[model samples]
Target chain A: MQHRLCFAPLNGLILLVSACVLALPMPASAQDKVLRWHDNLDRAAQASRESGKPLFVVFRCVR
Target chain B: MNGVDLARFEFDYDTTWQAFFLDANLNVYSRYGGRDEKSADGRHSVASLQHTMNEVLVAHERRRRPESRSDADLQPAPRSKTTPEDIPLLKAGHQGCVHCHQIAEYRALQSFHDGKFSRDSIFGFPLPDNVGINFDLAHGHRVDAVVPESPAAKGGLAPGDVVTRVDDVPVRSEQDFRWALHRVVEKRSVVVTALRAAGSKPSQPVSIKLDFHADWRKTDLGWRKSLRSVPLPLGFLGYALGREERRTAKLPDGRLAIKVVSLRGGGLAGNLGLEKGDLIVSLAGRSDERTLDDFKSDLLRRYAPGDKVRLTVLRDGKSLELTGPFPPWDTTDTSVP
Candidate 1:
């Protein structure tokens, strides 16, 4: 019964940790799969060629 | 953007943000961003961007279709690639990074030095409102509203019509329409084609001729960063007086009351002996209700290089006159910043 009691807390702790990890925000690299971005034009052009998708080039003057 | 193809990717240099929709071969499908003096983000919307993306996708698919091989629209134009490094003036001016506004500035300065500069060059990428057509924010090329008695209205443009082309240039977005309008070098009538849908019938193409008058390309130049490069130099930065300040100066409402706060050294105002705290009451002997921008636009429109200007200033408790001739427009030396 004492061993069962100790194992029950360990199971509960594992469940709580799993939930926390699942709830965490996705990493940028993973999210990039949905909306890929490339700072370099050559890489973006290559991706566009391979995927047969159009390129959306944005020229932003931050200043 | 150092190696960016200037010949293929031309846009409004003054805009802080711009987007180009292109294909894998670097063939431009359409442009997606433009702005007016109203606000930077006023003409842009997420909905409009989505609409443009969908349209571009359709166009891309159509181009890929085997049967569409004969389509001229799918063919890329022959253009000689020119980058910022190709421009000698720009290369000579800056060492590291070259800005978009600097591209326009150096080009204008070079044109001025080459004696090919026109005053109209100062105005670039005019808004469609100049033609009296207000585009829908959600659908960039769709007419949301047409000003009554405007050129668009008189030419049979109505709200809800989808603009297809301007002067035979296919307009896929509002920026494309502006690009077509910007190419209009002379004040003349240009054809605008649109598609109108009635009830359940197929959309029918409609053509309208819009007559443009002189000064139709002019817009609020105050927000344009490239305007600083224009040879028409306003040597002093003037702040418009508020109602309280105007009343304190005994200036009536709806009258010009600009307070000169600072002067550029060796500028026209400094050369005219315009003081730092001088309250300018009138310009060219007229006092009207105008903001600082309106005043600047008027100054640019009314006077040319080498033209004489008279300013009525209120110094201390007395009024004084400051008159001087503008420096020659082409007097800018090789050391242009």
Candidate 2:
């Protein structure tokens, strides 16, 4: 069973902080895949030109 | 937003993107550790790393999963975290707000509650006059209403309970709650002293630490996305700490400015009738105030259920008096991207 989890907006800050205290931390094994910020193009921009919205990049955890 | 959809939408082929991300992360994570007190402070640093990756993956999947759902528009995607990193590209990829954090951003957010990014902007939000919390109940959640799903829920708190104190401070009023919050300035998770009200008498207190959302909404501000579809330099745009009820400031004219972030939410920001853009040059006839210290004071760390306080603010260049309650919370973590 894949137990899903959610964290703060900080790429690593939230998880880093949570790791210190969450009772049963969200284990790496819970999901096999992860979000690697190697340039999703949209993630690099400051604001959007088309939608006039900033990009919300989400990486998935593959279990 | 899910992997399936992300991959499906791709009309071209490029395996290079995946390879670079994995390799880059290996470097960043390698340099970082889970338990470095000097850095991460002993606690569960490694656990935090794990959670960070965990949330990333979950967010990616959440965004992508819905595209595959039978009904596309009918079934909305799940909410994502609203932190800075999630804002896609609010800032051009050039700016990294490593130093200018929650505290630094407070200045830019002066017109936040009113939705005015600038004093010259024609649009803004309808902010309440005061923001306050009300946590007048037993701890351990004997009452469903008392349990704030955000912190209390994470702290393993359910409704129908009793909270004697946070960090050993007897919670008698809302001000006390604000003080409690201020006390835990840097504590990731604090020692929550609680008693279950389920029994004839109070149950033994239980202490637990939880990872909660930033609780920015409590600050009495609107976290607005871009008015247009264009990407902003940052995502999740809003006040960092939200707004305090009343804050005294010295205008260039040497007049005491009283600005109230909000009193409707709760806390000193509210108890004192603090309003948006109001300034306070003094409190109780004393102009004693510390800018940075107040942002990171232990006294502010104790905000929890059933806390009360008193505060004063300057509104329209006039001093205003106010008092109110600050209770625990349950919130719309919709911003959790």
Candidate 3:
């Protein structure tokens, strides 16, 4: 019983890892490539809120 | 505890009186064990209904009443056919299949430009691809928007071109026209005839071919459930934006300037500051010269949202830089229509 209980969690962990491994390869969506402006999310958050527009886009130059 | 119970619980693990005791226990275990467990009263109701149906069926069967079984036809049907006449068909037919099957709406409105947009590929605004139909209902008699730059576009089929014939077939009704389309060879360019006018006597014929790869929005005759949201071709992306042309503007030198009249969605307007009757001239910094294709790639594939955009606005004749984030594609407004 003890071994069975322990194995269930281990099996779950393996299943989760497997699922992520399967989903890792697709290309990013139009909304997925958000550029990070500042180290903290504050600047991005303020821009999004103040933009008054429902959809706010942030592009960063990563030279 | 027994083999039978295990099997029974495995299948009926979620419902029924037999599983009722296990439900509370499972809830307790989940809450304590840090596992998520949930239930729906709908299932219980459905299971009870199923039990009642089964009992009725069995009772009727065991009674050996053949006549009564025949009488079952008089009983009300368990399910009603969903034939809602109020619902207009989204597609050419009364079928609503494409709208239901295609869930990717609120979807991508992209243009068929060279390379997909990346950060370095910010072409100012996203370029838009034209609809596959001619929106004019008048020309709708022949063909809708011949998809932008598609084989139909390249083949010479314009928006108002009334499709009168396909090779030799006469397209009287939508069905007749569709049948002719079915007969055409995929990717083989063929001549098509259209009346060109609602009351025009002689029909003008033009040739167009299908490309090897078909646009996803093409309404191929298919089976569909009738109950679905109305389908709008081009996914609601209308042809060329900036229709409100000939408006006023203020130049940076306190003078008047040219306002960008109209713009298509997934186009450069979604990125630039030159709104209706504003002013224009000078893009990016220092009046960078850019091509239409170059400006479109950025919005579609490259940037997400909240990116800094610097545009040189020639408002009032003073070259001042207008700074703002690119407007997220907001086509929600019906005002444009």
Candidate 4:
């Protein structure tokens, strides 16, 4: 009976840790394609020039 | 690894996020994104973004045809007051992780150093809601809400109507709407083209003539970067209660109950015996629709600097009436305890 009581608390702690791991947020790249964006402005411009497409530029801060 | 030339394009410095739609040659076709003081992403919408992208594509095609191109085929961006390299903070070798707020703050500091600080410097660009059109960005610049009896509603703008164009500029996003509105300096009627039931049943075009009243420029200020020396907009030099705050104070609804939390610059409010915890019930002999936001907007939009305004407040559970002239935005001559 004493060993079973000790193991019960251990099982509860493991369950709690597993729940927390599951609840962790996914990285930006895993969630949205927009978040996983390219940062090479020069490449974007070059592509625009070659393909005759307008270069869409965005200026912002992650913080 | 190149940087966007900041001097060529004009953007709302107060906004946290801004985007530019340009031709391959760097000629700007239009802009997107805008925010009001209440929310950081107030007027942004995905549909508006899609619309702006479509317009830019069309403008791109027009640029190729020499005969179809006119002097205004693709307009050059307006020159800004300062460039990114001109800002001291940006020039300090920390421009890699540049934030939008820092750009505005540094620009204002440079403006003050150059002796060009004005009301427009701190106020920046006014939100489109000032004209009473709450654009739904997700629905492609559709009307989300219209202020009752406002110029938008009276001009025939209804909810769910898609704004296709403002004046001669193609309306795609909130930024385009603001850009068009910003160009209108005079108090003239603005033409708006909206389509009802867009992409659904038979759609019809609606023309709206939005007329502005005198003193419309005094509407509301957006969040802007300013130096500590720059006093708050409209010279109040104090803070007012928000809606949630009123409920916490047990103040009744449908009446203005602004709790004066602090007074600064020894301005008129502090000089006239107004202190912290004073609840303002009425101003200018008007007590109807008394909310702090509404009152502040009305006070600033209706009165100018040096104009005296009457106020009634409840301090220490006692009623008091105070009147004083509006103070300048940079008054440091007076001090308060």
Best prediction by TM-score? 1
Question: Candidate 1, TM-score vs. the true structure?
Answer: 0.79
CA RMSD of each candidate after superposition: 11.1, 18.6, 26.0, 11.7
Candidate 3 lDDT over B126-168, as tens digits, reads: 1012124442322223464666666566666676676545565
TM per candidate: 0.79, 0.23, 0.21, 0.67
What's each prediction's clash count?
A: 0, 133, 35, 2
With candidate 3 superimposed using the best TM-score fit, by how many Å does residue B185's alpha carbon deviate from the native? 6.2
Across B1-337, the per-residue lDDT of candidate 1 in tens digits comes to 5767777778887777777777777777777678887787788876676677677677777888898743444324436988877767777776666677777877777777777877778778878898899999988999999998878988999999999878756777899889888777875778988999887999899999999767777777777666666766667787899999988889899888889898876566855788889988889988987777767767776666677888898999799998888655643544245
Give the least accurate 10-residue stretch of model 3 chain B, judged by summed lDDT.
Answer: B27-36
Q: Cα lDDT of all candidates, in order?
A: 0.73, 0.31, 0.29, 0.59
Ranking by lDDT: 1, 4, 2, 3
Residue runs of model 1 more than 4 Å from their true location after superposition: A1-33, B70-78, B235-256, B261-277, B282-294, B302-337
DockQ of 3: 0.01
User: Arrange candidates by DockQ, highest first: which order?
Assistant: 1, 4, 2, 3
Number of the candidate with higher DockQ, 1 or 2: 1
After the best TM-score superposition of candidate 4, give how far the Cα of residue B197 lies from its true spot, in angstroms: 10
In Å, residue A62's CA in model 2 sits off its true spot by 23
Deviation (Å) of B10 in candidate 1: 0.8
